[model samples]
Each structure stands twice: as structure tokens, then as C-alpha cells.
Target chain A: MIYMKRVRLFLVLGLIGLIPIMISGCLGSKTSIQALFTVSPDKQVIPFTANFDGTLSYDEAGRIVSYTWNFGDGTTGQGPVVAHMYKRNGAYKVKLTVIDSRGRTSVSSITVQALNPPPTAQFSYSPKSKLNDKYVVGASEWITFDASKSTDDGTIVSYNWNFGDDTVGTGKIVKHRYIWPGTYNVVLTVTDNNGGKTSYTQQVNILGGPPCNSDISGGDTTINGSQK
Target chain B: MKGLAAVVVLVVLMQVSAIAGGVGLFAGAGPGGAALGEINQAITLYNRLLDNFNHTPTITGNVPPIPKMGSGITYQAGEQFWITDDLALGGKIEYFRTSVATAGEYQSGGKKTPISIALDCSTIGFVLTSGFNFLHYGFTLGVHGGVGYYYSGFTSNITFSVPSGYNKTISVHPHTGKGHYNNRSLGLEVGLSMVYPVTTWLALGVDASYRALTAPRLVDAHGIGLDLDGDGTAEHINLSGISLQVNVSIKLDLFR
Candidate 1:
């Protein structure tokens, strides 16, 4: 009877020890939290705006309750996603941290690069000629082109001109003469140090000499022949 | 037909033994006799259908969806060892081949250019399977789950032609060498087999099974960009599909 009592006591103790293990198994497995995000337009010219998305972040056992963003430029934000603009050219490291309902946390990060903006191109020519509208000029007369009015955020490096008459020229101020009497289109292209270029075109109609011929016939002057 | 012939020969041998007072080479076999032997082998032919392909980036708003693969087929061989009366552990190797067609048009500057793309994809993989078999009078039903590594190879050709009367007519032909991607995923298989037991040492079975795997990302080889969800990144190819197969299995008692 004493031996039976000892066996029963041992059985009870073993069952008590197994209770916690069985309950834990029935409760299900625990999973670690995962954080994910994406940055749109990660590389662009300043001033640049980037959009961040952390909607893909997940918590295996619970829901994500909060999201925090640190835009390496020393600015912080709170949300599942946010947009930030960088005014200067530099590289910024963006980080996203997510907190689950169970107080578990995970972090993910990415790098964004911003570059200097391209220069704005502008130019104007002399004689105020409009290509779409008509402008008249004398044959064999010189037309002047000036690209000195062109502007850029950086230094203007070069100026190129297409005279539209199978001829080309280079300089800020250049002159070209059209020998034939027909409509011609002139184009001016300016380039900045950053390789940015802009072009302007104008049209001009050149007229030939007057249509009359004078001949002295037999020592007597007569205005007889029409212009050829 | 070859499987049928094998089954016929086995049945004839078993019948002869039965007529001779059942004192055959495989007589007096019990449940515990070589229970952990090679009990199943199969050869399967499957038909697979894939999801739609990724979209092209240049085409905007209301473009037709990308085309699906034209033909898909897989060949597989599997072997299993019986661990208990109703449980088995095994592995299977498979080879799959398929062809994809991509054709579209882009309109820019009042000109329409037609593009054609063709790709051939092949994959080889092996999976470890754990299954439970339920035995009836002459039929066995089973379900299995597997995890394995898969490697896929892709080769593609792209061509585009610009129409005449354009300021400049252009043609582009981009060649992509063989590209490969690898992944590990899980698969599920369920099958039913009819077992014709001819002798204690051999049986001929016919099986029909269905299998599926998780979809893996497929990268474009020609550098075509697609933003299907309005995200900046290109969308990946979808490879999720179901496969149906009919197999001829030969069950053997290797220990006997």
C-alpha cells in the first residue's frame, strides 16, 4: 500500500509538470515581427520630393499600432507613410520603425540621393523677327543674332547658331548674310556648363533688287526693258 | 500499355502459386514483415496553366492585359519508403518547360510601332514529401506536403519595327542570354490510386494527383519596365498555377 501511494504521488506530480507545456502548445506558436517599406523616386534633382510606403510591414501575431520615420536630414515623422522634400543636394538615409500591438518593434531603412537641378535656358535675337509671322529684309543684307540675353543658374559655356541656309556659326553675337532672295529660318542654341541647352528660331524673307532695266540705245536713253 | 503488360505477368505468376497450395516465394507475409521497405514508385505527366504575364510600361491607360503562357508540361519521378502501415516519407524530382508570347503596340508622335517578345522558361527541382496513406480494399488515398529548392532558367528575344514615313525609321533587336533565378517554397499534393495486387512482392497502381506551389517572382530580361500598381518599381512575373497528373506506380517489396 505504501508503494502504491508513492506511485500515485509521482503520477500527480508528473501531470502537474506537463500542464504548462500542453497549454503553451495549444496557444499556438510565436512569430517575430517584420518591417518593410519602399521609397518612391529615390533619386532625383533638388528640390526633390519622395514618398515612403510602409503598408507592407507586418506583425506575425498582432497588428502594427504605430509607425515612425526619421528622414536623415534631422526631421522625424509619425505615420505608416509620409512624404518629405529635400531642398539641397545631398544623400539622406531614411529609416522606418514599426511597433506592433504587443509592443514588439522592427526597423528598416533605405538611402535617397538628390542632385543639382538643371539650368533654365532662355535667349533673344536682334531685329525682333517673328518666324511664324512674316518679316521682310533686303537681299545680301546681314542679320545679327545675340544670345547674350540667355540665362542659366550656372555659367553659359557655349553658343551655337544654325543660319538655315546651309551655314552655321558660333558665338554670343554673330552676323550672317543671305545672298538669295527667299524665306530663311535662323536658329540659336545656347548651352550651360551643366550640359543643359535651349534653342530659339526665327524666320525672315529677303527681297531681290528692283524689277527695272535701263538701256541707252544708239546714244538715245530709253526706259524700255522690264525687270527680269 | 507497358504498365498493363507488367500487371498481367504478375497476376499470372500469383495465380500459378495459388493453384500450387499457396506455397509461393512470398507466402506467409505479415504486417510486420519488412514494413519499412520500398513500397511506391511513380512516373507522372502533368498539364500546367500559368497566370497572366506582367504589363508593359510604355502603354498607358486601358491597355490589353498581357498574354498567358502558350503551353506548359512537367515530367516527374518519385519514390517512397513506407515508415508505418499508413505513413511514408519520400522525395520527387521534376522538370517543367513552357513558352511565353508577348505582343503589343506603342503610339507616340502619331506613329504606331509593334513589338514582339518570346521567352522560353524551364525549371528543375526536387522536393521532400511526407504523406499519409489510407488503405481500402484495393484503393489508396493520400495527401502530401513538400518543401524544396527550384531553379528556373529563361531566354528571350525581342523585336520592334518602326513604320515608314517617319522622320527617322528605327529598328531594335535586343538579345538576352540565359538568366536564372532560384527559390525555395512549399508544395501540396493530393492523390488517389487504384492498386492491383498480383503477388505479395509486387503490385501495379494507377494514380491521379493534383499539385500546386507558391508563386515566385520572375524578373524581366529585356529591361522592360512595368508599374502595374502605380508604384515606381517594375512588377514581377506571376508563376502561380495548378498541375494535374496521371501516373503509373509500381509498388515493390524490396526487403522480400
Candidate 2:
């Protein structure tokens, strides 16, 4: 039994001696093939193009035969230098793998961040059409305001309007009219989900359309094109 | 601002009456350098917006480089009254302006946005000066110090874009019209000058002045501070800077 234990210890020592040789063979030489790359503008807003260059990679024992890229967005490419545009916003881990002529491969990775852009503000108003380059609307008439023309990459949380007459309203589509006949500045302010705010202002002229009996319009006046 | 300047003029004019000897009119202009204070804080505001995505911002396309406020131009017009041949007292109105206009891009990891910005600042000072003219042969060497009221104006047309999560672009403040911010503060200045004798009535002079001025508060027409860094407090304005100017002075021996 003691002789068998000595034999087992000898085998363990031999295994330890062989481990380094196996690792050395796998590790290659001091100038072993390395997959090194650089990414320009790795961080950007969505719909952004990034440039990747793997020319800095080197293989001392053999020529590098292949350069493969995994953009982490479920896309792949093959080249020494390539440009990729991120269509969506997210964190992407880009990988570059270089294979030498000897079939040895090395991999490097970098994290790319694509950010979201802000929403643009736009809107169109009806019964407030342009006449001779002027926005004209009849006073005390139904003027429909629409913000559907406004766009956002995400969701627009709120649409606020300042009717320039100390009256305010909210929604994607609203109706407002001036009480007195004059030129009024209509302002539409939109807020996106990201808390970004944008405003659009249009100067609209309100016509009295000759003298209207003020006695008949009293208390029955429709300032917002709605009967009070 | 005008009210305070008028009061200061009365106080200085009384002092001039006490020691009237001779009078000289001077007008000068030159390059200047100053601190931008809240005006530059707009860039910090821009960076903070970009940093929201947890990505480092790489800004490209700016003049004078970012974070380095800028250089400016100064014009001064004033009159000095000689209390004696070597001693004189003066009052001058000086104006200084600096401008910055940039259309650039901010890039983070893989995304980018465009930005267009314009900012111009002006400072007007009404000051009282005391000078000791030491030399008067080929060149006149003198040193002077002054105290005054400085009115600062900041005009901004700053516009920066951000991305909506939905793949659209929007302006942070589309209603951010051209806003003019104004502030006023008391100022202290000291300067040295050397004048070359061009003629009996005209002398060409070069002046180097250091002004120390700070406005504790700056506000817009709506009484709102131009707080760009998300900080509720408005950034103070610093008009302190060095100005080197070339001047032409007409000296007359009056009531001598």
C-alpha cells in the first residue's frame, strides 16, 4: 500500500511539470498575435456612425488572415477598418477578433453607447390660415389648433398653449379664439418624455369684421369657439 | 444704471472744482481680456445635457476652444484735469465687448448632435482717475488708479440640440430668443501709461490697465438669472481683466 501511495505522488508531480509546457505552447511567443483595435466616437446619439480600425493588431509568427467584427447589435462584419452606424440607442459591446495564418485567434472588445435625440416641435392651426403672408382669424370664431405636425422620437407628454390673452390650454389638439379684435401671438409649447421643452409662436391677426353688436355677444361670447 | 452714474459724476465733479489747474481730453482703444463668468456657464449646461446618457462628450467646432471664455476690444473716452503739473484727476467712460459664435457637434460613444451658439458681452464703465505724470521729455510716464460704476450686458443667442429617445432631434429651448442680461457693479482699476510727444497739442500714448470688477447679480428682462448649469443661483459676472490701449490725448493749459 505505501509503494502504491509513492507511485501516485510521482504521477501528480509529472502532471504539474507538463502543465507549463502545454500553456506555453498555447500562449505562443512574446510577440504572439494580438487583436487590438480603436473606435472613434464610440459614444454618440442614435443614428450615429462610428469608425473601427484594427490595423494596430499584429502577429509575429504569421500573417493575420482575417478580421471579424461583432457589433453586439446582432450584426457582423469582416475588415481591417469598418464603419458602422447605430440605428438605435443602447449600450453595445463591439468585438474584434483577429485570426493569424497559424489559425491562432485573439479577441478585443469595446463598449459603445448610443444616446437618444430630443424631439422637434411643430404645429399647424386651422381657420388661422395665411392670407397675403399673414395669419388671419376672425375674432370670437372657432380656431382649431393641431400639434399633430410636431414630432418626437419618443412620446410627447404634454402640449401646452398660451393664447396670448392670459388664457392657457393643454392637449395635442385644442381650440382657442381671441375676445378682442387685434393681433395676438399664439404660442404652442411641447414637452417630451425626457423633460425636453420646445415652443413655437405664430402671430395671428384677429379681424373684427365690421362693428358687431356687443350687447348680443355679452356673456354668450365664445372666446374658445365654444358657447359659454 | 444711468441714475448711479449721474450721481457719481456729481461727486467727482465737486472734487475737480476744488483743484482745477488744466484740462486734457483723451480717447483710446485696444485689445482686452476678461473673465466670462455666467456667459461661459452655458457650455457647462451643454455638457450636462450630453452627460445625461452616461457617455463622455467630445465637442468639436468651437472658437477660442471651449471653457476659455475669450478676448475682447475696449474703447475709452475721458477728460483729465491737472490739479498740478505732475498731478491730475480724470473721469472716463470705457466700453468693452467680447463675442463668441460657434456651430459645432457633440459626440458621445456612437451618437452625435449639432449645436449653434452666439454670445456677445459688453461692459460700460464711468470712472474717476487720479494720475501722477512723472516724466515729460521724449515720452511721458504716468501711473493712475480709478474707481467707477460698471454696467455689463450679456446678449445670447444660444441654441443646442438633443435627441429624443424616438430617433428625432429637438431643441432644448426653442423659445430661447435673443436674451439680453444686464448687471451693474462698482469697479476699481489701476493703470500705467507712456506718452510720446507727437505735437504741442497732441500726444500718442500707450496705456495698460487692470480692472477689478464683479457683479453679484445678473438678470434678464424678466428678472430671471441666466442659470445654465441647472443651478438655481445665477452665475456672477466678472469684468476684471487687463487692457492695453493706444490713445491720442489733446492737452490744453486752461485756467493756468
Candidate 3:
């Protein structure tokens, strides 16, 4: 009975020692391979086409690994020798994360820009259509002006009309009445959505009642005279 | 996912280590009667220090009501009393100053004249506290009770200037009034904390306490500067409400 009890105690101690060894061996098989974090040249710009080359290896023990790249443009890609192209222009922080066989990971970050050409604006006014050659002063008349013939690559948001009489309005079509007989310069100014503007002017004349007819009578002789 | 998993693993490891360390250290040290007596003595000393805080004379007040209350700051203060080794009760006195000036709205007067209203209130209160040490694990739990008398005063003044065409200074009682009444009210307090021993006689603790005060109805009669429809007094006045107290106290162990 004494021998059996001693054997039992020895078995318990032996099992206790073996448990840690077994766990250590199982964990050792995982082999912590520290990730290789790298970026080529450390800098570049967008339209950004760059080659990514990072080789992850083992710490004396061989382990397979994977790489993930965050372009920081709300986009992510993966591979070892990854090729990337940035579409927009701005400074972007790029991140590279590597994971080893045991699911351990390491990350690196770099800032780069997307190079792009400066934006341009181009514009031209619509061809002007004639409204009548002459109209009496103080007479109201319909003057149809077409402002849609204008074109701008950027975008045209508004049109301002200077009716030549110091009266101005905004829109494609406007009706104007001249209260005085005078030669006035009518200007149509159109502006693009980008704030780029171009103006065109037209000469308009207001005739004063056929040169003001008058009648003259001297003793029995009557003559009709008109002031031009 | 990887970062998150790493964090989770670290936290699990830290928790396991803390539990293991605690059990190991306690078992190895084993309990000695003399050591237990020393701990008891320390607790007694801590409670005695707490008892030294005998009377909580308190003063608290709110800014004048309405527009003034929104723009002004409220202040409160309390005095503490030590009732027992594990309990400390005190009374508090508080004062509040809130002022409203019509200077901005009535830059030029017709009906638009300068008026200033300031409502001040004060309270004297009582408080109760209970404390206990947490088995060397460095934690304390406590409950609090408080009661007080609240007083309020609402003062409104109007200074009007005659129109440019007329030469006269008109003084009228717009709403310059005083409301003085005393009401007995009760307040409840609660707090929880963790205490860490810095030395044999010194300790550091972090605690958050809250006090809620309920009082009688006090009218806040200050509002719109002009009585547009030709009414003698301006309208749209309301009553004042209850207040809450929150404090983070850094305590010093004044004695062993």
C-alpha cells in the first residue's frame, strides 16, 4: 500500500511537468516570424504609380506571410510586390501591414501625393439677335434677347443685362422700354458657374417721333416743315 | 482584426497575471494576528480623521432667472462635519448671483429703455457620509444624506430716458421686487471609489459624488424688455427649478 501511494504521487508530479512541455511544443510550432516593414524610396506623388516591394521572411524558422496596403484614399489592396495607381491629387498617407504565420502583424506608414494638371476655364458668348432698329421714346416694346447660344466649358450660371439706360436685369429674356431718345450701348454680361465672365455690347437708338412735324402759315402761304 | 485580437490577448494576460499575483502574494504572506491588528488600527485612524469633519455649513445660489440665468454662472460651497470614525456629516451654505441688464436691448429708448434684473438665492444645508475600507484591495463605498433651507430674491429695475423731443426722466416700477421665503428641503448623495496606499500613512483615492436638491417654487419674473401691446408689465415669466451637485474631491490624509 505504501509503494502504490508513492507511485501515484510520482505519476502526478511527472504529469505536471509534462503538461508545460507539451504546451510549449505546441506553441513553438507557431514560430513568431517578425514582419518585414518597408516602402520603396519613402516618397512619391499621385497619378501616383509606384512599385511596392516588401519581402517577409522568418526568424530562423520558415513561415508563410501576407501583406495588406491601405492607400488612405478610402481604398485598400494586398500582395507582396503590389502595383498601385492614385487617381486624385493630394497628400495621402499610405500604410502597409504585414501578417506572419502565427497571425502576428506589424505596420508602416508613408505620405505621398497625387500629381495632377491645374484646372482650366474656357468661355464664349451667344450670338446676339436684333430686337428692332428703332423705337419711339416713352413707348413700351417687347425686346426678345436669346442668351442660350452662349457656351462655356466650365459652366454658365447667370446672365446680367445692361439695357443701356442704366436699367439692368438678370435672365435669358427681358422686355425694356426707353423713356428718352438717345443712342445707348446695350451690354449683356454672362458669367459661368466658375465665376468666369464675358460681356458683349450692341448699339441701340431711340427715334423721337419722325423728327417732330410742324406747320407754318404766313399771309395766304402755308408750308409744312419737319425738323430732322 | 489583428490589432483588436492583439489587444484582447494582452488584456486577458494582464487580468490573469493580476489574479495570480494576488492569490500568490496573499497565500505566501499568510495572515498574522499582529498584522491584522495593525490593519485594524490603520482603519480606525482613517475613520477618526473622517470624524474630525464635524459641521457642513453650506452656501449655494443660482444666477437670476430667464435670460440672465442662461448667461451667468452659478456657484456653491459646503462645510463638512465629522460624526464618527467611519462617518462624517456636515452643513453647507451657498449663494448665487445672476444679473440681467437691458443695456443691450434698449440702446435707445422710447419704450425701449434700460432695465436690469438680478435674482439671488442662498441655501444652508446638512450632509451625512459613511465610509469603509475594502480588505486591502484598495476600495471604499459610501452613502450620503443632506438637508437644507433655501432662500431666493428677485430684483428688477427699469431706467427710462425721455424721447429726444421731450425733456423728462421717467422712473417706473417695472418689476423691482423681492421674494423671501424659507423652505426645508432634503438632498440625497451617493459615491464610489478606489483608494491606493502611497505610504504607511498616506493614501490616494479617486471618487465621484452627486447631490440632488429639491426646493419650493420660486417665480422667475424677468423676460422681454418691451411690453409691445401697451400692457403695464412685461409677460412670459416662469418659475425656478431644482439643482444638482457634482464634485470630484482630492482628499489629503491630514494625520495618521
Candidate 4:
């Protein structure tokens, strides 16, 4: 009888212990809150704006009543979502804190990177004319390539040109003379101080002048030992 | 007086019979006669991460242009309690992640510089669902709906070679950073599942779900701002899509 009584006592104590655990598991839902969030376009070129949303933050058993944001730039905001713009290039840390209806809070954070914008490539050539007239040019004719129309956010430092006739030059405006008439390709490459570069290519046709000995060679050009 | 006493006794007996019937109904109700409770773990083949990063530009050949987001994977675990034969209430936790890389060259002043870019993203959250078992035969068909939280973000890294005209070569270092965002606007999810029971307690299932949430804005740790749409204001990232999952579930008969 005593052994049976001890077993019953142990069972009652075990059940009492389990009662608290079960109740806590079901009723303590709001005790742990997870503060979560996301940032769009996290990496960007300078003069950038970023958007922040904390709608994904959650309370385990309750509802989130408020959201607070710290932009890491000495700026703060209150809401479930917010937006900020960075004017310069650098790295910044953003943070979000969410409070549940039960006064429990959770925090989340991320890093944002902003870099200087790369130079844009834009250029125009002078003498806006087509090489369609027989696609021909006189021998020893001079052709000009002007890359002054190219633009960059920063100053353009240099221009390199390949005349496609075993010739190269350096300048914003370059002139090349083709001695033997043929089709030639002209290429221009522009570079900025930041090492940014862009290139453009144009085709030119240079027609060879009439052969100097066209008439003398056809009929009777023969050596003393050999005749045709 | 004798008739009143007899009527009272009859009413008492009827009440006892009704109570006994209610207890019998509760005892007989089970989850399709297989079990009264279940726990499931699933592996998800998710393609939605690709939609989230589709607009960010990356290095490609000679140009830096935007590329499509890549596919990803997720895992989830859930528990359900059947209150009756056909209806159940449950909750789940899900985790997802993805990563992608791009490389290209930037050319200028007759010189070419190599550039590389990479992105990594992850998410973790929970949801509560109400499910209905609509069909039962060789296989069981169930449908569910829920509201939950979705926490996600990405880390981006960019490296570029030093340009010409610098007296000293500046060592190229990768610029890496993370942006965190969240959606709390009552995220909604709907799913359909078909399960084939191998035994009384174990089942294999295929589940397809569609989830929708408010678009979250990405903000870097540095608190930098971005005007993605050029409207002079900041914009949010879109992180909504569908998921296909394969799951294994085990039924527990403790309640029954």
C-alpha cells in the first residue's frame, strides 16, 4: 500500500509540473518578439535613395503596435515603413526596432553601400556626311576624327585614336592621311581621370588614284631576251 | 404530485444521455481515422528570390547591366492539431537563402579593367494556418490559408580594377554590404497539398503555396538612401512569389 501511495504522489507532482509548461507554451506567445526587416537596392551609385519596410517584424503571440527606425546618419523615423536618400558615397548602417502591443521590443539592422557613379559614354563626330558616293576617296586625302562631343561627369583626360593604317595618334581632334586608297577603319577611345573609358569606330573609304603606268605596260613591254 | 415526480426523473435521464452522446462524438472524431495530430518538415523549391533581385545591375561583358535573380531553396517545419475529422489548426517556420555572381570588363582609354559583382539573400519567418482536409481515399487532399511575417535581406559585393593614370596601383578590394528589410502588413499565404499515407502514422506529400506581402524597402547598414525608380523618393523591393514543397509528415495519436 505504501509503494502504491508513493507512485501516486510522484504522478501527481509530475502532472503539476507539466501543467505550468503547457500553460506557458500556449499563453506566453508574446514573450519573444523578433524584429525583422528588409532594404531594397541596398547597393547603389551615389545620390541614392533607399526604402525601408518593417512590416515583416512580428510578435510571437501579439501584434506589433509601433516601428522605429534609425538611419545611422543621425536621422530617425517612426512607422512600419520609411525611405531615405544618401547624397554621398560611403557605407551606412540602418536599424529598425519594433514594439509589440505587450510592450516587448525587437531590433534588426543591415548595412548599405553607396559608390560614385561611373562616367557615361557619349560622343559625336564632325562633317556629318556619309561615304556612300561610290564609297571612294582621293589618294593622300586627309580625314578628321573629332571626339569633342564625348561627355563625362568628370573631366575627360585623354583620347587615343587608331587610324587602321598602321598609324595611331593621341588627341581630342586627330587628322590622318591615307596615301593608298582603300577602305580604312578609324577608332577613337576616350578616358577619364577615374580610369573610365569608352570607344567609337567609323569606316572610311579612300580610292586609289589612276595608275601612273596603266598605258605603258599593256601592249609591248618586253625585255631584250624575252617577248610576249 | 406523482406525475410531476415522474416527469422530473425522465428529464434527468435525458440530460445524462445527451452528455454521454457528446463525449462519444468527441472520442470518435479523428484526423481521417489515421491520427489526431501531426508534425511535418518540408523542403521547398522556391524561385521567388530571382524576382526580388532582377532589377539590380551587374557587370556583363563591356557593359554594367541588370540581370535576373536566381532560384533558391527553403526549409519549413510545422505542427497541426485536428479539432474534428476535417479541420485543423497549425503554425510553421520557414527559412530560405540564395546567392549569385557576375563578372565583366570596363574599357576606356585603350585600357580594360575587370569588375565583379555578387549578391546573397536570406529569409526567416513564421505563420499560422487553418487547414481543411477535403478528400480522403488512397490519397488525402488538403487546403490551407494563413497570415505571417517574412524577414529577408541581401548582401552585395562589388570589386573593380584600378584605372589608368594613377601613379601607384591602388589594390582592388571588394566592397561588401548588407541591406535588411521586412514585411509586416499581414502577409497572406494559401496552399494546396496532396498526401499519400504509407502507414497509419507516416505520409508523403507535395504542397504548393502562394504567398503575398507588402513590398519591403531595402536599406543598407550604413543608412544610405536610394531612388530606384527616379521619382526623387525611395522605393521598396518586391519579394513575393510561389513555392513548391515536398514534405514528410508524422501523426501523433496522443490526443485520440
Question: In lDDT terms, which candidate is top?
Answer: 2
Considering the true interface contacts (CA pairs under 8 Å between chains A and B), give the fraction that model 2 also has: 0.00
- Model 2 ranges with Cα > 4 A deviation: A1-228, B1-19, B41-67, B104-114, B164-177
Error of 1 at B27 (Å): 21
By DockQ, the better pick of 1 and 4 is 1
lDDT of 3 by residue, B1-256 (tens): 6597468546644553443211100000111111111112222222221222111112111112233231222334443322223334333444433343322222222343332333333433343333322235444444333333344333434332222322211111123333333344443333343455555333444443333343433334332332211124322212122223333233333321
Per-residue lDDT tens digits for candidate 1, residues B200-225, read 54555544433333324445445444
lDDT of 2 by residue, B1-256 (tens): 7798688778766776676777889999999977654445445445434343234233433222334454889999999987766667788999999887656655545566556667777899988887776667789898777788889988778655553231312112222446788988887777789988788778899999877776656789889876643334565667677899999999887665
Q: What does candidate 1 score on TM? A: 0.40
Task: Please list the residue runs of candidate 4 whose C-alpha ends up more than 4 Å from where it truly belongs after superposition.
Answer: A1-228, B1-67, B107-112, B159-185, B225-232
Model 4 accuracy (lDDT, Cα) = 0.54
Residue A13 displacement (Å), model 4: 47
Per-residue C-alpha lDDT of model 3 across residues A103-219, encoded as one tens digit per residue? 676565556655433223222222323357433232232345556666665566676777676567666654454545577677777776645567877766654432233222111
When 1 and 4 are scored with lDDT, the better candidate is: 4
Q: How well is candidate 3 docked (DockQ)?
A: 0.01
Best by TM-score: 2
Which 10-residue window of candidate 2 chain A scores lowest in summed lDDT? A219-228
Residue lDDT tens for model 4, A1-228 = 575455446544644554443333223121346565567667887688888767655564589998998887778999987889987666788888888888888676778776655555443433334456534555554455667688877788887777787767777766555666677777777787766677778777767663563442223211111112
The Cα error of candidate 4 at residue A41, in Å, is: 30
Score chain B of each candidate by TM-score: 0.51, 0.79, 0.36, 0.62
